[model samples]
Target: MILRCNTGGTRTDNFAFFIYAFSSLFAIVSPVGGVITFVSLTSDMSLDEKNYLASKSVILACIIALFFAVTGQIILNFFGVSIDSLRVAGGILLFVVAFDMILAKVSRESVTEKEIDISMERSDIWIFPIALPLLTGPGTITTIIVLMGSAVSVLQRGEVIAAILLTFLITGVLFHFSRRIYKFLGYTGMLVFTRLMGLLLAAMAVNFITIGIWNIYLSFQ
Candidate 1:
């Protein structure tokens, strides 16, 4: 009975971890944004070409996310930045992103109009704006780093990595079906969804800030 209880507790903790990781990454990545960008960029391409681009972009994003997850702590250490400081800074950045999302803006902080215009001139977009700023932008990178920093054990790190992989997989699938999703959601539905996600992200940003501040306080005491 004790063993069973312990196992159940572990399962619950893992579930909670996964949910937080998934939701935070999802809000930051904003697959709906990916759908819009993918559809527009691939409007002139064939279905096969669209599928190929989507796959490549998603795979690239997954690689980038994992790279950050592994190296984030090292990078922070090199920079002499504490995880709590990163959390505070990242929280501020995320809050700004959430504000843009709430306003139904395309998040110029992630992808600016100039970048999109330049991308239009390029033939291969899978590596450019699509994979970089579109799918795995600064916001997403910071979120992953923060989450990785918070991970206390190998198992927890693995769970965070798994969540990143799963989120990008879902993102790729959504991009592959971008046209269908756009038609189903329409512009208004998409705006509503973005706003709702923004609200959630804003709340998360507050939580991050609070935790960061509390940690900083504890360190001094």
Candidate 2:
């Protein structure tokens, strides 16, 4: 007990892991308010298909998260990129998403376009942009990779997984109530909230870049 406390080992490490897991949860799933729209548009699908799509999205997110957890450091090291460099890159990606959110462009034409014939393209929907990248896009992936790097133990990993699953459930509920939220908030209100989130994200980007640079500096010494 005394030795462990002096060494700052597993207990302290698990605490840090929990913090990172929770932080990632907050950052990634903050868009739960938009879920209703997603559900309404896809209501035509059978329960099986809906469940399949949801599972696919969750699986894709988890797979991407796992990949980053395992390969993030090795990939960066092989590419001769420092953690700071990766952070800066991640920051830039977040900035792009944040800018979209701030400008109210996240759901403008791209995601809302339901022009496709539901019968014609239904099968491909779950596997394509929806699951592979759109919902869990670059910003989400980068954040996961960063968190995986910081995760210290099995308990922390379990916490992160729980957080993500909770996010998925929240997303489902949001989808269920999207129409009401949209009506309540209105388009303008949505945009305003998006912009506020964007401002927060921009600040997060600056921190990422600063920390990345600091890590690179430390690596040399």
Off by over 4 Å in 1: 1-9
Quote each prediction's TM-score.
0.94, 0.70
- List pairs with backbone clashes in candidate 2: 35-174, 35-175, 36-174, 36-175, 36-178, 84-212
Name the top lDDT candidate. 1
TM-score of candidate 2 versus the correct structure, residues matched by position: 0.70
Error of 1 at 47 (Å): 1.0
Worst 10 residues of 1 by lDDT: 1-10
For each candidate, the alpha-carbon lDDT, in order, equals: 0.87, 0.60
Residue pair clashes in candidate 1: none
Q: Model 1's lDDT to the true fold?
A: 0.87
Q: Over the stretch 151-209, how does candidate 1's per-residue lDDT look in tens digits?
A: 76677788899999989989988998998999999878888988999999999999889
lDDT of 2 by residue, 115-135 (tens): 323423556665454544545
